[model samples]
Target: MRIRKDYMGFAFLLFLAAANHWLLIPGQVLAEGSETFYPYLLNTALVILLPCYAWEIWRSRGRNDAPLFWEPGLADLGRILCLLGGIWLWADAMKHLGFILPTAFFLALCGWLYGEKSVRKLALLALVSPFVLYALFTMLGAALPQGGIEIWLSPLLVR
Candidate 1:
């Protein structure tokens, strides 16, 4: 009766997702109307699927051969910290800078950090990805975050 180390983090995430689905989502009003329909469906799927995933992980826990992958070195810790900081900053910025600019900047930074050295490719991704995502969600009738910058630049960017 031994538990594999790598399985714990995934198990914890599954538990959290399921708990959030069952405990928190029910409290939130998700009627058969408005934009909440998608969230409701997603939550339903997660609530149904997460337990099965957890059970599978538990049943098929394998030996940790790549033991070093779990343990973070100094460089890995620094990169993780940078990513966390970037996420925090992005969340903060989204209130003032809006969704597109901050998201694009964050994605570009992430791409650069993850070894995307081609400036043209990174620039293309940074410029196009946000607009495409915004359009996709907007087409689905989802209201995206519109902040000061986006409002000011709407004439140039938004239709």
Candidate 2:
């Protein structure tokens, strides 16, 4: 009997879920609080959801006959490569430039690459999102890498 392509993908996801619970989460030395809660919750959710996904895949196996992966055209491939390169540059830039600037720049570049033509909207998104994220993560007790701007702003942002 031939196994469906969707089943293979499901199996890969199942393996990742198992790895997350058994291999990844076990190694983390979590503090006494909700830090441990999220990972276990994620694992539990995956345990519940993967079966449902598998069932859906099995139930609709006959209806779908798509290939294992879609082939992207040259333009699509170029866009994907540019996005990846942008991500790499963003990460490197973050060390020197700080979270907000690099993130804003990356967001703007991504927006342009992904066909967001409105400069005002892109600027708003690029500028506002990093600050929002920085504030959110700060409130959540996550330590992000800091540069001059972050160092200057930390007094106000961090409690």
Most TM-score-accurate candidate: 2
List the candidates' TM-scores in order.
0.60, 0.61
Best by lDDT: 2
Cα distance off (Å), candidate 1, residue 34: 7.6
lDDT of candidates 1 onward, in order: 0.69, 0.78
Off by over 4 Å in 2: 1-71
Q: How many pairs collide in each candidate, listed in order?
A: 0, 0
In model 1, the runs with Cα more than 4 Å from the true position are 1-34, 40-71, 148-159
Can you give the lDDT of residue 17 in candidate 2? 84
Model 1 per-residue lDDT at 15: 75
Residues 72-140 of candidate 2: C-alpha lDDT, one tens digit per residue: 578977998999999899979987888889999999999999899999999999989999988876666
